[model samples]
Target: MVHETAAPASELVLEPFELSDDFYQRPHDAYDLLRARGAAHFVRFPDGGTGWLVTDYEAAKAVFLDPAVSKALKSPGAQAALGGDAGGAAMFGDMMLFYDPPEHTRLRALVNRAFSGRAVRELAPRITELADGLLAGLAEDAATEQDLLDRYAFPLPMLVICELLGVPNEDRDSFRAWSTTLVSNDETPEARGAAVSQFLGYIDGLIRAKQEAPADDLLSELISASEDGDRLSHRELISMVFLLLIAGFETTVNLISNAVAILLTDNGVRAALAADPGRMADFVEEALRFESPAGEGTFRYTTAPVTVGGIEIPAGQRVLVSMAAADRDPSRFDDPHRVDLDRADKNHLAFGYGVHRCVGAPLARMEGGVALTRLLAAYPDLVLATDTELSWRKSLIVRGLTALPVRLRP
Candidate 1:
């Protein structure tokens, strides 16, 4: 039988565990603690359940690719252990990430066209234009202190995804709000539930619209996909769109914001990138390794008893792979904590590994490369607006900045 409990934050005693304040706020410190401990360790959740937190790099890659640990539809217990609530169950039940192969493989194949290499290249011109437009607006207001995240980082990704998915321009505001609440752990359960409901309702209408009058958007393509006459069900299509919106936009937002935060704080790194725009890709890669947006890997539940990093995790136990910790593992990276844009063989688990690797990774890389490159090119003297206190989202699953205030030099 599965066990659950709620103990004092201090009693958890895991080096990688978050302090109460940090748990609800910034989690980099917690991940650092975990890295200090070792590869894998036991963690006590807020609900009192004991779960394995994998901090080692190679071990995390192993778990991510292990078919023995299934993401099948029946793993509701595993979902809950990953901090998912009832609404998450409803919306994520049919997503590609929640299923093990051959179902996972089949679904991923059908949608791969959207993110395929050729498709991403086709979208490049559009992405560049969008980035330029956003920067134009920022430039006008660059005279005073600005929240780079609010003015640029946040809207850029949302607009790009909305354009890609064919979400009506006017409806993006509501969609953005709904998507934010659904991924937020700070909100009450009821609030999240309501957000999910609203999101589903909106998506349902969009799917119907696509059915009646299909467009060339990703949603239309997903709505019409057929594999040997097998296609996504209505519910599956809705869930897929929901997943794309959250995964595509949220991750990029954090990545751009996090890269900016890191660049501003580290003058040496910032100067190197500013000096050589060609080196932006390396800078982005190191940023991803140094501080990943997804704080931890998606939750995985063991379908059969398995030993990971010498720890015996029994069947049905929830396992969390700390992407932040794994990326910083000393075994895989020398001087892992330091930001080295020139670091070679920088194969960090930032996009995860194996079957459940982020589908939108290519797109995210393209977006980050373009955004950072342009931001540096446009605002050569950008600096933090103030030495303001930075706040993180409450959700452990995602590491993101709540607000990033900065000033663009004239």
Candidate 2:
């Protein structure tokens, strides 16, 4: 449904979009309106910069895979929107996220081994064991209410990521605070900047320790990669770790939380999976499509004028691929809002679309499958503590609940 034919960027008077209170409360409704209007909406982002928000699935997929769209977020407005950086590129360094082509290709290759299929396959037993341990503690309170995000969802992935990166368990508390603030859309730039500084500083010290005494861990491997024939600069090394730690667990945290919420709320989806444990993988995939954890993909800047879904967006403007909207676009899926675990199409853009698609998705799927299996096995009657509407966290990109209150037994 192209609302209008494409034209030059300067000749367009696009309808403005904003992140209103209604959007925060019922994002799907807002997305429905946007999709009905056109593929992309021209608007100012919360950070006070103008850009295009692509909610249509076809347009978003095209945007993600389009070479014309660069990963660089160099615009000063984008910087302010992403939470003003204290040291800019030098501080954040050459993050793989911001790189394109040869640079992105090279950096991703370096850390790819750490998350290889073989590596993750070997971690299966450990992951199961970790899930078992968490469930044991979670079961201690037989009938008491608990926030699944705090008790199960957050820790499971956080622990796995920390273990993979060789981060000390004692420092996880700090990571939780920093990560929450970092992903939050409500935090002030000053606060976000402080968190970034402290986070990188901690990583710096940890790297120093790993260098003095290398260990059998991903961080050690990354450090070695940096020192070896294919060298990684100090900034790149720190940024890689930062990217891994944040991307490694945060998305998974929301995935697990969102899935449980669905299982507790939707009887049909729950019953189908409960009847057949073999359907766990299918359930996880459907959950990703049904309730994408990462609301919007990482911001992108256009290098050249581009036309998407009947609208022309000029070069140098920011582009946001709204997975939250795209995943639910009615044109792409039949009854897009329903949780149809049996649906034939599982090709959702929840993780993302192209080279920049979340590299941790494999690990996330494996962990999510394990966590959901163990959770249901432990508490077959898991249900929300109250029948109230769950409060979603207000974040620029993070899609999760402020708290997922549930009881071990219904």
Candidate 3:
């Protein structure tokens, strides 16, 4: 598919990928057109910068695995696009996501033990218990129209991540607001800065508490890593905690909510899963492939001139994979748009590719499977209470519903 450098960056005429109406309403339609044009499209960003948007699976995988593509926020334009200041870009600092190989390797190694297979297995019972408690509350509520996102999807993951990080239940309301503000695109610069400041303050305070008296929690474990000679810096500690809270909670919230949204809308798939509980994992996989919580992978800067899908992207330009688009690329999967839970190959780039793949994916899958399975068992006739199309959160990266209204019973 390599077609040679599509002119030089300076000479190339940037076409307006005008997706105002279709972007929110039906993004995949827009993606289809973009993919047809080429593997990479020179589109305008929210910040008014033009960058390459890779929707082809092969090109995206290459971009992800290419060492020439950097994960740092060193570029001023990229920093602006990510809503970050000059000093610190998004997830900047000694965090794994912002670092390249050696640093990312070191940082990822420090916490890899915490999210190991053993750790996730141990967390299963607690997650199930939490889901049960949430379902009980939902059943008790007299309101016929219940918001699954608020009641079950949002809180379940939020509480689980908070508990893992040792964040108190009382502070969850504030945490929720901060996390939402941090992820959303609706906020102004001043608002985003304020939210970032408050979020940092809260995380710093929590970290200090964990450092003062370590407990039997993930935060305590992370804090104690310094004591064991791993030596996480203050910035790194805060960033790690911030990442876990946001990544662990926000992403899972969308996954759960999106899966339910699909089930309520697609009766055939719903009935198949309801009849066979064993297929819940497959259902979750298909959902992830279809409606990825993360629409685009994090920003990657081209360190050297690179050709993606045969188009040469000049160095110093920002680039990213459209996971939502790539997952549905016709070349990669047969009938990519269709929801098939029984597909033989369920492997998709929902979590991402290479080292930067979402670290919380294991926890997400476990929780998603448990949540869908038990929710269906508890309320067999669960259906959407509203006839309107579900509204989505206004975000450039995260794809999820603002709310999902459903009735637990007929």
Candidate 4:
């Protein structure tokens, strides 16, 4: 039987989170208010779900380590709180993000083999080549001052992930639209469901094709495992592929875009990276902390009563760890707002912590480093286009710029 709990009297309630408008422009300001109030603030999320938002670094880490916390989708009150037909679970529920040990452990182990460091290392050269190819197109559009997100940042990761999953490049545009809608806070649940259905159907077809004629790709390897050991069901296979493909490049798109914006705006960082191009990795780390690409970690619900930052949260309630806010916790990071490439402690929760940490982190880091290094080398005088206005993506989970117009030459 499913167990649940009632809310305690000490629960701190606040207004619904403002993900659009002001919050999109300056999310830190809102995060600052929440952090100042306490380590954790109970807020009605944009989806109308009331949950605890952990803002401080220590608190965030504690929540990650707490055994009482769970990734199970059957949270007692979460569905009603989120209103009818919550679409997030349909997309992310069957994946690793919403599973616990034994199930999570089994799935992680199988996928981990394909994402091993050696595999990522082998792909680095191809990623660098891909970046150069994308840069060539950007150079062609130099005179027009194109949007960086559209011209390079968005397509590069999308292409790489498509190639990695052995999916046809021709279908890129369709999945790109699907990805945008899935993570978008602006889309309605019904709309999001349509996108999910289409994406899963496509993936289902891809998996079946791989099963019949195995190839030298990750999908083939997974299909092999499924056929050999009956280790995976159809839903698990589709969900795993979905998680990898979406989580694989979506965050990297934002990371690379954020790096370009940061490097151009801050000459000091640009000069530092220019002097020692090897520090491109460090630059990516700082960007992860300073302006986290993934604004927040996936949701976790408490199986038992737990206290975070002295606020008592009862069992069965949802919890959200703000990775963006935690990375900038003044207590953990010095000059938290500043982007410093030389900082000794580059530890950031951008990829998350513990068991639920991103499986594609190594690929993300390599992609960011290669993209930054090549982008800077290709366009020595790259700077944001003053004529165009910059806009941030209106998303609570993923934080990034919608458009970053830039000139190729100084």
Candidate 5:
């Protein structure tokens, strides 16, 4: 769903404007400007699609509640509405992120078992062990200064997901490379395509192997996962694996990296968390709000004219709910910019809300908590590396540092 605009409709109170690429690099100021103008602002993507960008917390929560405000790219109109956005719904294959109700509902049901509270709780010891190994590696590296994202943040979740999904240790590097390429805006279209091709091809081969020799892993379980006698098809299995494989770790790596960056820079937060390691849950949640890893929620399309934040968007228009903006809305969060571990409101849209809320959230939170606890306990003097400028990943939907250079010792 998309509506092209050269000029604003009189009713469109917040004027439509094109967003700059730099917004990703420095977004809080832009978010403050938009949120002040109104709850919903009509914005145009650089790629030529026009739609509403929801900055108000209430408006964003409303959008999540409305099932008619769609997520599927199955329609040509929907695809056109998100024109030229490289990592559009297609990159995700036919996973839950791109689907609404029935399909999403079915997929969520079939996959929920893998990320249930009990399942994640069961994964805690292994997660702790993974974090310890990575931290030990970081400590032993030649340089005292290291890119935490490379040394620990990326590896913790990547290793956990790979192990859970049954990816062989030898092939984990290939998956990491392919994943990095697919989510990267710097990668050329051909490169991204090939990465997607290679990722799916590998998954295809793995699925066959799992079929012949099913193991005690999520992939094997997904192959047999069924909802009301509806089992996963070969394609669905691949998409589900792709979703789990990438989303399972990519978002988390960002969360870990972002959280660590916060812990290093925000002394009050770091001290509180360090004093009482149990406060890490609060630390992680606040970090998600202050700097959402998934800066923007997945692109949503309007199936019918829908009113959000007092703006009525016509049918067949794409809508982007900025979880990054919504999380920091002053109305919902007092002193939103501050990194307070004891904010009265514990709710945040970091994992999103409603039906499509990330099914893997419990697991991500556990991983984030474990990673931070392990690192801080090991390196109480960790600080951002001298002369380092944190580089945010260029992807529009992803909001995390490409590298988090830090000194393990003061």
Candidate 6:
């Protein structure tokens, strides 16, 4: 194993183990040093597993598009390598994101119809209604600052997904709690296992209900499709529901929250956007590029030897493509650090590239666009709440603010 001495004061111990702290808390100075060293480097997992961290834009894209490098699930001993616990098993087995082609293609194709632009467009009216309702709740407390996340950002996406999936409105709280536990970084092995089991139980119940009496919801469609042998297996169906519940809500939640946070912090951008509602699309793209929710792409394992950024990755090794770093690559983007709403080359890897691109991109874009436009229009004087550090989520795979406190304009 290659052992480079840990950079001065680096949180990563330069051993074959996981980094000490979550990537979000790591000092910017450390990131700068690593960036300067190269876009990709070897990092040790806490379990003594070695993995590659790809930070450069070209290298990240290459790793993402290259079929030679398999997603972590495809790797032998992948379960043990990725914590070998119930959570790991659940992630690899049920999520299409972890699977490679053929299976990935089939699963993604089955769900793609439901998330198509036409289908998502049909929900725009409802999405707007939901956004307005959430905003209405915030309006009552306009005099005092509110946590945008709790008041608006979080619920909007969750509600939309639940409604789409035909999850009963009364069961929303239970769904939220179960989802929170499954995704929470604070949960222990036993706790996570229990949460996973409970979540699966909930999905099983929901699926059985859908099977008995179909509805016009997405889950109903998935159930029908699977039953007709046009889609997934029993296990796959449960996994897809779980995946949709998590992905359907989580990514959009961060996107909307992050966009508002950026706009509130930057007066010029906010004023510019507020002046023209038509610029909402471009502004959303900039937000995705500047502060992507998924900091890194899904993990992949080398099915065969592959060279990335001039470094040779041996077979059976894990690799991570840093979406955050790629979106900021100066080579592809001029003045990479600045948020340019008008930047013509916004072809960022934020949604990823190649076959595994995010299936919910259109819906995410619509939700974010509508949320920001309505937000800026309604609260022309929205400003950040004072004395809040804007705690970020701890997951290295997903990047987002935990809470965004803001004073809605009267």
Candidate 6 has a TM-score of 0.90
**Which stretches of candidate 1 lie above 4 Å from their native place?**
1-19, 24-26, 46-50, 76-88, 117-119
Q: 1-410, model 3: which lDDT tens digit per residue? A: 11223566566535435445336556787788889878987776554445678899888888889998888665544454445553356445556777888878877877776665344458889998999888988886524988899999998998898888888988888988987887776777677778888988999999998888887788877766632467678899898888888888888899999999999999999989868889999999999999998888567877778898778887767787899989999999899988998788787999999998888888899999888887888888898999888898877678999999888887
> What is the overall TM-score of model 2 with all chains considered together?
0.92
lDDT of each: 0.78, 0.82, 0.81, 0.80, 0.81, 0.75
Q: Can you write out model 2's per-residue Cα lDDT over 1-410, one digit (the tens) per residue? A: 12332566664556456656545556787678778878988865555555788999999999998887877555454454445541355655479988777788888787775555343557768888999899999777759998988999999999898988889988899999998898887888799889999999999888889989988788887877631468666788889999989888988999999999999889998899878989999999989988899988567777777899978887666788999889888888999888887889989998997888888888899999999999999999898997788988877577888899999976
Clashes of 2: 0
Which pairs clash in the backbone of model 2?
none
lDDT digits (tens) for residues 1-115 of candidate 4: 1011245544314333434356667778878777876898776555545678899999999999887888766444344334443337656667877787867888887777656
Residue 296 deviation, candidate 4, in Å? 1.1
lDDT of 1: 0.78
lDDT of 5 by residue, 1-410 (tens): 22334555664544566677776677777788888878877786544446778888999999999866888887543755656352445556487778777888888898885554343457889999988887887766534777888878887888899888888867878978998887776778799889988999999999999999988788888887776888888888888898889889989999999988888778899888768888888888999899998888567887788897666787777788999999999998999999998897979998999998888888888889888888888888888885655778777677989788888887
Show the colliding residue pairs in model 4: none
What shift in Å separates residue 72 of candidate 2 from its native position after superposition?
Answer: 1.4
Ranking of all predicted structures according to lDDT, beginning with the best and ending with the worst? 2, 5, 3, 4, 1, 6
**How good is model 5 by TM-score?**
0.92
